[model samples]
Target: MNKDNENLVKSYRLLTVWLLSLFILAGIFSVLLIRLDLNLSSKVTTLFWLCFVSFYFISLLLMIYKTERVYYINYITHKEAQQATKEERRAFAYKHLIVFCIATFIFVIYSIVSLIFQYPAAVDFAVFIVIIIVSALRTVPFKLKE
Candidate 1:
């Protein structure tokens, strides 16, 4: 298959998985809300969501950092070899920075909204604070290698 077709298939597969997971999560919450006491349900859901977001957020960052290492290495190598033009390099950097900013903005907004709902865990609040701080660091030009 061509690269385009492969990418399209991968995208659809990812979307399908994401949608299915979201539906399952919603179904779980729905059952909880229906079967449990209102206050108890809120607490349970709050803890579940807090843990879920934290795990996903950490894993997302780790995955991005790992993949970013490959991109950064390729860019550096190509740049030194004069295979990558200055304009192309700048555009690549701009794209990455923009994505980082957007992701940070999204998480910060999610954190804020979650806070407004008053998640019962102090851990959620702390994690959100850390996310905001890390987002602020997204503009740095250095590699985020471990």
Candidate 2:
């Protein structure tokens, strides 16, 4: 396969591993929190969530930056996007779809688990909403100039 295809595959693999690790980490943390019965004071819980959210967003940004750098065509202008080959466009769409689906699935699972555990106002619900909104916005195709 050509370099583009190779890079695409590599990116997918990297994303898979990164997401899986995130899922495992979330699971472990959830289990621990449940077992601990969240006995900590509200201040400590808020602090912990603040740290977790900060770390999560930072890591997510870094992962996206790294993945885009590794893949060809990290950014395409409107003209360039229009000129891109059918295969290139398809590959781009597929990549976005895969990411959206996987992320949505993971967050949905987390949210459900948290709800089941009776954490109605859990951060996972907020994360689930944010993921859906962002993914949907990102997946929307740009309008082509007539």
Candidate 3:
């Protein structure tokens, strides 16, 4: 098979696996929400919703990162991976940074609301850290071996 075709197959596999994982996560959270009556208060509800939204967004970002990596690798295999023009790569990196910033901003708003509602900082930070790590990883450039 051609490199492009192989890359397409890999992307499909990743998407399928990630989508399944997300569905399972949603199911678990839904059960928790129902069993514990987690949305009884404004604070608890805000925190819950924040967590739900953050997880979905981060999952999407990770999926994009994975897809981009596949594209990069496939381009290299096909000898189509030109040395990225400085401005082009910089702009791409900047765009990812902007996305991270937007996600962090939303998290901050949720954290403030959560704190006001007596939610724990530890819980907030734990979720925030995951976002930070994923965003940070996405910004790094990967070199390919010949």
Instruction: Please count the clashing residue pairs in each candidate, in the order shown.
Output: 0, 0, 0
Best-to-worst order by TM-score is: 3, 2, 1
lDDT string for model 2 (19-125, tens) is 78778887888789889896875534543554454456446545544444223224445344445444665556455546665665666566556645645454654
lDDT for model 3, on a 0 to 1 scale? 0.56
Residue-level lDDT tens digits of model 1 in 1-146: 22222212112343355457766877887788778857664544565565565455444334433333223323344223133333443454554555555655665566566667865566565665666567546544543221
TM-score of each: 0.35, 0.37, 0.45
Residue-level lDDT tens digits of model 3 in 5-106: 333332346657767887898788778878997457655565666666666755655554445433332223323222333333334534564667677776
Ranking by lDDT: 3, 2, 1
Please identify which of the two predictions, 2 or 3, would achieve the higher lDDT against the true structure: 3
**Where does the lowest 10-residue lDDT sum fall in candidate 1?**
2-11
Q: How much is the lDDT of residue 114 in candidate 3?
A: 65
Model 2, total clashes:
0
Candidates in order have lDDT scores of 0.48, 0.53, 0.56
Q: Candidate 1 versus the native: TM-score?
A: 0.35
